[model samples]
Every structure is written in structure tokens, then in C-alpha cells.
Target: MSLSFASSPFSVVCSEVSFAWPDGTTVLDGLDAAFGTGRTGLIGVNGSGKSTLLALIAGELSPASGTVGVAGEIGYLPQNLPLGTARTVSDLLGISATRSALHAIERGEATEENFTAVGEDWDVEERARAELDRLGLDGLGLDRTVATLSGGEAVMVGLAAQLLARPDVLLLDEPTNNLDLDARRRLYEAVSSWPGVLIVVSHDRELLDLVDEIADLREGGVRSFGGNLSAYEELLAVEREAAERAVRVAGSDMRRQKRELEEAHVKLARRVRYGDKMYEQKREPKVIMQERKRQAQVSAGKHRLMHEDRLSDARERLSEAEEAVRADAEIRVRLPATEVPAGRTVLTVNGLPAQQPASLEELIVRGPERIALTGPNGSGKTTFLRSLLGEGPEGLQVKIGVEGVRYLPQRLDVLDDRLSVVDNVRAFAPSASVNTVRAGLARFLFRGRRAEQPAGTLSGGERFRAVLAALMLAEPAPQLLMLDEPTNNLDMASARRLSEALEAYQGALIVVSHDVPFLRTIGITRWLHLDRDTGLTEIEPM
Candidate 1:
């Protein structure tokens, strides 16, 4: 698919832009960028100002310094979609007013006010429905309340709203975060076919791969790379390799400089000894000896200062080189105690059914089987997962053959907000001493003081890790671990960290995630899909 969009009619540019949060945390500083139409995938580690930049471009926030210039109307879909139960899809699509006006005129009230409201475009409802249908919300009418939609459905609705606006410049932040696989493909198609300037901040690999270019936000600056995510990754791999090589070379140079500095000091000391010995032996005249000693001291001082300066320069270069090499820590969990034997039965489901579109007459999870639950939004995947965990949504029965069971809900409500990460884990494993809990948390990348941070204060990725640690480190050692949409709201690095942590899990794993690539990485042995008509069915691994 062609990623190119029309140029000249749309443009967005930022020159020397600087911004900071109210708490003085710098987000963007002197960042300069431009978008002259086409899809731009905004990517970076979480908290790297990608979303902040999008906000700036969309005029949601002003830059503290510099300017953000735009030549066309902008439509923005923020990361956390503003949702209200009272709000309807029509209101969200910005067509309710027109629809009402047209309806009033059709009811024989041809008032000038209603006519003016209708304006020239009288097919607002049709357009709205068409947009929704194009985005996989075909059956969802404009009057449907936002509260009735699932997380994925809500996200798609928000996207549909933006598309209906038909703005020249579009900004989407983490657009595919809560999207199911099919919904993601629909969104990707929309993005790929966009005819205006489009900037999307997301960690969705599939969505990013459809972009024309990538804008990497890092260290309060922006770096644009041509082509999509895979291309950018290839370029980044090369850059990292070069950076590591530079670090090694600089380190070697630093050591050599230090050695030279030491040798110079030794030579200076020998010269001093020779001069003192010559003076004691009176090899030359007393005045000549004093002058010679004075010259030797000056020479030694100059040599020492030069070497010290060179060494300092080498050290600075080495530090810069090291900084260029990414050293993000990966979670390395080890939970041998949670292992389930190959022949053991972990869980059994008996006649689990949702209100509609889902039913599970019978199911059995055997051994350390890792099952990935896949389904479209509103297919009752989350509902089934919650029912399996005995959380909510009645009319479901499940038997836990295993002694230990732990479920990490999509919201990650398992951790108490007031408690520290260590304390939360300790709550689950009360028998574990503070030191032991802290040590276990370190494996989840919450080492030392990070473990002491209150759960309420953690970032999304940190919160997931904290919840995972609490679930895995419980006293009974969870043999049947269930995660509902665990990869949602996580950055690429955090998702990878999670996958790595799951590598050490020898227990039965049931993860409901839209990230198919992530499931593949974690070694999903079975795929259970919730279908609308057929209900819950086991399918071959995707």
C-alpha cells in the first residue's frame, strides 16, 4: 500500500519548540520539526515527549518557547479518549447538530435558524454512518452511548469521529493501543489511505509499518527517518552497533591516555631524581644546576598538564559514547516454584456464557499450556477472563484444579494504590521477608528504591510490572496465571520486558492480548478464540 498523502494543502511545523509540565519536568526543549503531508509514525520510549509533541501540534497545549505553525484544521485523537456515558456516537462525530437541524426542517419547521444550522452539507448522518462502517463499527449507529462500547470499540469510535471531521492535519496518539487485531487492520487501512498530513504516536508494530516515515522523539528532540518502522529499526540497529563500537574504541583510548599520563608522571619523577643526584654529586656548577632544575620542573608541569587535559577529553568522549549505547534493563523472572507438571490439570471451565456472543460449554487447561485468547471487541473475551477469575459478570462456572491461581486484570487493579510495590508483593507473599520480596521485585525490574514507590505513582509500564510481581511472587506461587490484555497501555520496551519475564514462567499461562507478535514471542502453545456464534473454541496457534 502506498503510504504517501497529498502535499501542499496541509502542513505542520515546529521551530525551536520548548515545553515543560507544571511540575517542571521538561518534555520538549528546542525541538524543531516539520510535516508536509504524509503519514508520520511518532515513536520513542514512553515519556519521551511523543504525545506532548502531538498535543502541541494539535493546539491542545502551547509551547513554552518557539512556535508551532499549522496551515490547516487539525483533528486529534488523544491517548486517553475522553469518555462519558451520556455522550452518544453522533455527538462524538460532530454531526448531531446538523442531524438535528435537518430533522427539524424535515418536520415542516423551515426556520432560518434550522436551515442555517444544516448549511450546505445535509448528509451528515450518512457520512457519520459511513465513517463508522469503514472503521469496523458497521452495526453501531450514531445514537449508541459510549458507555456501551468495549475499550477497543471505544477507540475505534474515537477514530471514526476524527475521520468524519475530514481535517487536513490529523494527530493520533496511541491509536491502536486498545484495538483488537481486526480493528487494528481497519485502522491501518485508514491510516495508509489518508490523503492529508497524519501523525500517529503508537507502539503498534503493524500500524507503524504502514507509515510513510517515522519521527523519533528522544532527549527532547525529534529525528525523522524515511520509511516505516521496520526500516527505522534496521537503521537503529546499525546506529546502535556503530555506537557500541565507538564506545569500545573510546574506552580503549581512555585507558591508553591514562597509561601515557602515568608514564609521563614516572618519567618526570626519574628526571627529578636525576637532577637531585646531579646536584648532590655537583656534576655541574651550582647556578647551572639551579637553572636546569627550574627548567626541568616547568617542563614536567607542562607535560603533566597536557596529559591530564588529553585524559579528560578522552574520558568525556568515552562518556558520550557510552550514553549513545542504550542500556535499558530487561525483566528476568525466575519462578521455578510456580512450575506445573506436564500431566497436571490446571483449570476447567463448565458452561461459561456471557449475555450474548459467547459461550463455553466445556474447557480444560492442562499442564503448563500457554493459551492466548483472541477475539474481536465485544466478543466477551474480557468478560470470559474475568468470569474465569471469579471477578464479575455472573453465570459462569470454572474449576481450578491447581492450588494457586492469579489473574492480572486489564486495569491492573490487583495492586493497592496506597501500598508500595514491595508492600503489595508482600501482601501476597506475607511469609516472604522484606529483603526477599525486594530481591524478587528486582527480577521484575523494580530494584531497590523503585520497589518502594507507591503503586499510585507508577507509570503504566511500571504499574504492569508491579502487578505482575505481585501476582507471581505470591506465597502459594501461582500455577495458573491469567492476564487480560496485559500488553495494553505498555510501550514497546515494556511489552518486550513483559514477554521476557514470561519466559521464566513454567506455569499455565492464559493471556488475552491483541498483540499477536507479543503472544508469538511468549510461546503460546494454544489459541482459544471467542466467537460470536460458535462460542469459545480452541484453535491452532496463530
Candidate 2:
């Protein structure tokens, strides 16, 4: 099933690749693609097998059929780094053994085992720290535990570990998921300077813009574009325009063919009637008239088949044309019940975290004001949200005036995996009937059987939507909605859909995110920054 595609010096290739989940859900089928040396941005909608393909290439997953070939050793960083709180920076960098062996050698206990572990890399620690510093993680020391690092810091450390290996191939899945503005800049520089074969799966537009080319995986195939994300988008826009026009033309042709078929039927009927009349009128010999009628019927049958075939062909063309036009739907839901009055007090935080950085002591949020919480990695933005919700540490006083306040964490663990999407939402909105819940889920694009699917079987974007449905459809409706890193791991279309869904919400919002572009799209009215040194402070929108 392998098909050769035109490529230049491909460093990675998938030949006749086919893969399916254990549940018999096919992801990729006979997918053939090749990635040339240099940075390639692998772009796709959620659940299009982009991550699965990376896994196959990185040797983390083996294909059920076909083969994946790589030019050399690989360094892979998955979308969600499997991190433990007790793991130290040295452990994360994968140099703990080497560092330990080097220390032992320095202590004059230079055994053969220690030398074997150390190998020829005596500067492993220095190189590891250099990579960390390059990614703007200098403040995080080697002995610091993962528990002390933020989500973004952990990601940076994982990347640092990969770069330290200097593998011939590098694979990064959503590398910029939790990185702040400055950290993202540092990553962009690293990506720009990468010389070897590099492939990244990310929804970050800025990061994609730095790639040498774009590889779009869709419909079980890979399409290579010669330029970056902007160029690919522009080209795609043009192609879609042409495809839409083709659809219109095909539609017209199909309609015309259908009309011609109807007209041919009418003409055949008229001919049959005329032949019967001629036979009845005795215009010729009886035998001759009968023979003429038989010939007329045969001719009519042929004519009918010809017109039918034409109509069918035209319909097939129309279908093919329509398939080329993408209709990525947006989430369109209205929640008037979540609206709040202008003078209503939503929340009042009487105190802050009892840590150093005594910057702000009190805060108040009123009405449906949308606030953006931004900060550097490890600056306690997420912790601040938890403290305000009374879910985390002690000595942090907070008073919530709103009765209906909901929080959507970055992990999206609110839903019960075993339950259907409808049931999950019903759990939050217990009073709402099944029919009523279904009618509401339709607005989120979970129509019919999709609403009945278990939460575990959903794709990344679908799970996000399902979680949002649960939060918004909760009993009494959430008057204050808090989301932490809501856009992490979300495809571009999904992110846009999130904004579209939020357009109908009339509730107060507190969002902790590092994505400034996303914050702008969601209409943040106030911008706040949290720092360990300065505590919490208000800043103007960029």
C-alpha cells in the first residue's frame, strides 16, 4: 500500500503505515509521508494521528503494518511529559548517573563502573545547564525537584534533556503548551537554529511560522507545503476558493443532467404514445407498425440509461468537490442564565498567599468583567487560582460572593470517563432532563450519537467541548468561570471554537494563560501579573 511521494533528502519516512487503537478504531491507514532534513511543522486538526505518527517515528509505538524509517537516533518530547513531583532536575535531564559518577571520580573513588557510567562526557552537567539556560531556565538548579517547578518549567527541562542528547532527529509535540512570552521567544530561537532533522507538532502559530516547511496530515494522508504556516494558509485559502467554485459548477451540472433525464423520459413517453396512435390509426401495415413500436421502445431504453449515467457522474463530481472544502464547525452556544448584573459582587479575596512578595493584600471582582492572569513560569498563577477557590494551601483567605463558581483545570478531569457525554453534563446539571441536556449539547456540536459517546473515547477537542458543556450547563449556571491554561494542547480551530463559545457567556471570567493572542480573542478587560518577588500587580493590556 506504500506510495512514493516527491521529497528532497527525506530523513524520515512512513511506508504503507496503518495503525489502529486496541478498540479497533483506525487512526492512520496506508499513510505514506516523508520529512526532509530541516524543520518541518506537522499541522493537523486534533486526533488526525499527528501525535501517533510522531510516536511511530520516535519508536515509542510500533505500527501494526508497514514500517517507519529514520535516518539516525531520535530525541522525542511528548505533549504531556510524564513527570513525577519527586523527580529532580538532574533526573529530568537524564544526567543523574553521569553526574553522580563524575562526582565519585572527583572523590578519588574512580572505579571502572563509575568510569563506564561517566563515559567520555565529563561536562554533562555543564551542557545540561547550558541547554536549560538557553531555554531561559537558569533560575532552576539541578537538585530542585519537579514539585518545585511549574508546568512550563517542567516542559522546558524535558526539552533541555532532549537537546543535550543531540540526536540526529528531534521531535517535539506541542512544545509551547505552557511557556510564557519570554520562554516562547527563547524556544523560537532554538527552533530557528536547529540544523538537523526536526519535526514539531504544535498549534502555536508563531512557532510554526519558524519552520522551513509545513507538513499537513489530514484524511489519512500528508500534504507537504514548501513554505511556512502563513504560506500554507494562504495557499490553502486559494485552494478552498477554487474547490468551492468547483462545487458550485458541479451542482449546476448535476441539476442540468437531472433535468435532461426528466426531459428524455417525457420525450420517450411521447414517442411511445405516437407509435401506439400510428398502430391504432392503421397508417401502415399492422406487422410494420408493430415492428416500428418495438424499435421505438428499445431506442427509448438506451436514451434513458444514457441520461441516468450522466446524472450519476455529475453527482459523483459534486461529492468529490464538496469533500475538498473544509467545514470545521465552531461551538455556538448561548448561556443567558450565566449573566450577572453590573453591580453584583462576584468575588472578594480578603488576603493573598502567606509567602514572600507582599505586593497586593486584597482584591475584588464585580459584574461580568473578564480578567487575564499572566505571569512567568513558576510565578504561582495556577496556585493563585487554586487558593482563591479554597482548594489549596492554608492562610490564604478568600470570600466568594457568587453562589455558582466553577473551575476548569488544565487537565480537564472534570468528566467521568465511563459516563456518556450527556451523562457527564447531566451530572453537573442534575435537574436538566436527558432531552433538555441533548438539546443543549447540540449547540456545542455534539449531535445525536456524539452526545452518547463515552467521555473517554472523545478526541482532544471533543473532550474540551464536553467539559465546557458540563461547566456552562451546571445547575444555577456558573456566574464566575475560571479556566487555567484553557488553550493548552488545543488545535487552532479548537481554540477559535473556544472563543466562539465564550462569546455567548455573560459571566465574570478569570483566566490563567500564557497565550496573549488567545487572551485578546476572549476579550480580557483587565490584565494582572503574579510574581514571587512582587506578589500580584495589575498591568495594562499589551
Candidate 3:
């Protein structure tokens, strides 16, 4: 089952691969490709077919046409993890002898002698522990229930479990979405040294730059380019410019043809009038008739050529240019703001504990201040947010001011899946009319009929925008905004837009995100580090 030791360098191959959903939506069309032993970043907008392609390559979904050939074992880490309430990390790993024995017995391949030989002296438990440690989950008890783990901790554990398989092809979907700076660095380091092929679906530009190539999924197909992130961006820019130039040229040519055709018709009309006058006078009759006929034929020929030949290419060029411009347009997000009293404390924590039975000490925040909460995964980023939100009460006395606070949970809990985007925004601010809600949603790029679509049908980025729209609609807008992993599913342009919006906000901002550059861009005035060693929180001016 371990394909890493195989002789083949190329781990995955796809030929004329095409896939469609049950509803007949074409997700991929004629995607012919081969990937070998190197890290390749997969970049695309939401619903651009990145996730679907990853699933197809991982054998989780079959292609509707052609074939997907896997030369080696594949390990896939799904975007959404399902960790049952009763399962512990150790239980999930199948490290215990009892579970291993059960698996063997179920296979009908284990005898009493083999079972006894394995016994209670299983190395799987130790190996699991070692892997967890390597993932920076050291000292965390294996028997600790998964339900109690924070979101970041759970993600790290899942990643550790997959990495332990040592697969020949590793397919990761937004692997660093919820991780902090240190954890992202660790992940990057791990992938950099991985011997086999890595196909990663991520919106992280820094992570994409680390890859050997970037595969852009767009318009139901994939385009592979051998370059880093910057190079790929430059190529896209150049292509867009060329498309624009073609469109301009086509427009000019169409205009010239129209003028020439009009001139030809005018000349033909004059000649016919002169011929009719000469014929009426019974002077030069045959010559006038022939001249009129020739003029009519010439005008007709010019009109036919203009309609039949020149127009089609012109229209095609215009369409291509429009598509290119659309592709280049950055995602737009507009965050509403309100005036708030300056210099008020929004959150204050003294002796806070991020982990169960452990303590985090001295975390504090003031009003109208931008702060970045960062640390390694499982080092209490989300836990710290929860503690501030009054979700956890252990070794800390947390105090939140009476000011209006808005918290955007990491998983987009603000979104109502059953309602339309407009309805969701209206729910947050009922006094605002439906038209007002629609306008606000439009600011976030959900325009016209798109605002009427169900929230469940929207892609990840759209869903995030919907949630943000709801937040913006709230009256007496929140003076304190706490966002936990806000940029997880957002594309690069959207992330930058969100950062810009945050920077422009007049209210206090407390952001917990894995994107280091984003955090830096938002102008974090302070830094909060949650230390896992001593279960303490430290804050310093940036």
C-alpha cells in the first residue's frame, strides 16, 4: 500500500478526463494532464473546479469521460473534516491493539497466533505519538477526546494523521487555511522536503510561490504553467493585455467596414438617380441602364461581405476581450462602519487558559485598536478567541465591554444556508428595506439576481461575502470586530480587499488569521502571542 517506495517518478496521470455533477453541471472538460514528483500549486477562483479536480485525482470521484490513472498511493486531506464526538486522536489513528486486531479479524486474515504476536505491544501507538509530536502536538494526550479540541488543534491532528501515511501523492485542500504563521511555516517545510508529488489547492499566494509550478483551473479546464506565483500572475496580465489589444483592433476594423459600406451605397444611389434621369430623357439609354446595374451590384457585394465576413470575427474578438477583463477584475468587498467612542477597552483577559486544565495568562485588548493574534497550530489561537467571546471559562477572568461586538467565526457561522443572500442580510438589519439590503450585498459583488440565490448554492468566497454583508448591515455597527480565520476560503484579491476594508474601518479590530502578509497589511498595532509552554498570553506593541 506504500507507493512511496515504488520506482515510478510520475504518481498521477490523466488523459482526456472530464467530469460532471449529478445535476449535469460540467465541472471539468477534457482535462488532459500528467503530474510527476514535484510540488504543484492549484489556483482558481471559487467554483473554478479546483476542489472537484482534486477529488477526481484522489479517486474520491470518477470522471464522466476518459480516465484517471494513479500510479501510486494517494493521501487526501479534505477541506471539511468530520471528527466524531466520541473519537479520540488515538482512536482515529487505530493505534490500539484492540482496534488493529478487530481490523485484522474483519479482513479474515488474522489467526490466533498472529493476534497474540501483535498483542498489547503495538508500535502503532508510539508511531502515532511521534507523528503528533512532529506536527507540534506534543504533550497532548492521545486519549483526549476530539470534541474538546479547538478548531486549529483538530485540523493539525487531521493533517498529522494523513502525513503519517507517507503517501506517494499528497493532495491537500486549503491545508493552511486555519493555521497560524508558525504552523504554516512548519507545513511549508514539510511539503518542501516531501519526495513525491504534491498537488495543493490553496488561495495562499506565499504557499503557491513555494511550488515548482502552478496549475490554473478556469472555465472548466486546467492550464499548467511552469513558474512561481509571480510569474504566473505576470503571464495572466500579459494575456489580458493582448486580448484587449485584439478587441480594439477588431472594433476599429468593423467601424471602417461600416463607413466603406455606407459610402458605397450613397455612390450607388447617386449613379442610379443620374441613370434614371438620362433614361427618362431617352438619351444614352443602354449605357445608363448598364451603369446603374453595375453600381447596384458593387454596393450589394460590399454589404454582403461586411455582414458575412467582418462581423463574425469582430464579435468573437469582443467576447474574448470581455471575458479577459472579467477574469482580471479583482473581487470587491465593502465593509460598513459607524462612529465609535475612542479609547475604550473591548476585551481584557487576565490569567486565561486556552487548553483544558491549562492556563493562559494576561491577554488584553483596547477599543479601536488593531491586534493580530498569532501562534503555531494547537497553540491556542481559536481558543483565545473563544475565551474572549465568553465561550470558555477556566483559569481566567475575562471581561468584555458593553459596546456592540461582532464576531465572524472561522467557519462562517453567521451565514444562514437556507435563506437567500438578500434575506440573510435583511435578517441582520430588518429595518433596512429589501432594496437597501440588495445594494449592500452588491457592494460585496453579489449583484442583482445573484443576491436572490440561496446561500447554500454560493461558493466558499461568496458565502464569506454574504456573511460579511450581514455583519455590515447590523445597526449601530459593531465597535469591536473579532474575526477568527477570516481569510480561510477567500481568494488572494478578496483577501486583500478585506484587509483594505479592515484597515479603513474606524472600529476596533481583533483578527486571528494564518495569513501573515494579510495581518501585516492590515496594520496590526499590537501582537498577541499565546505560549503553549507555560499556558500564558503575551501582548506587545508592533
C-alpha RMSD by candidate, in order = 4.9, 3.4, 5.3
Between candidates 1 and 2, which one is better according to TM-score? 2
CA lDDT of every candidate: 0.82, 0.86, 0.75
List TM-scores for all candidates, in order. 0.85, 0.91, 0.80
Q: Scored by Cα lDDT, where does model 1 land? A: 0.82
Off by over 4 Å in 1: 1-10, 15-24, 62-66, 328-337, 341-344, 353-360, 401-405, 411-478
Q: What is the lDDT of residue 85 in candidate 2?
A: 79
Query: Is candidate 1 or 2 superior in lDDT?
Result: 2
67: Cα error in model 1, Å: 3.9
Error of 1 at 255 (Å): 2.6
Worst 10 residues of 2 by lDDT: 1-10
Across 110-196, the per-residue lDDT of candidate 2 in tens digits comes to: 899999999989989888888998899886789998888888898899989888998999999889887899989988998898889
Q: In angstroms, give how far residue 241 of model 2 lies from its true place.
A: 1.3
Clashing pairs in 2: none
Residue-level lDDT of model 1, residues 171-205, one tens digit each, is 98888766787898898888989998899988888
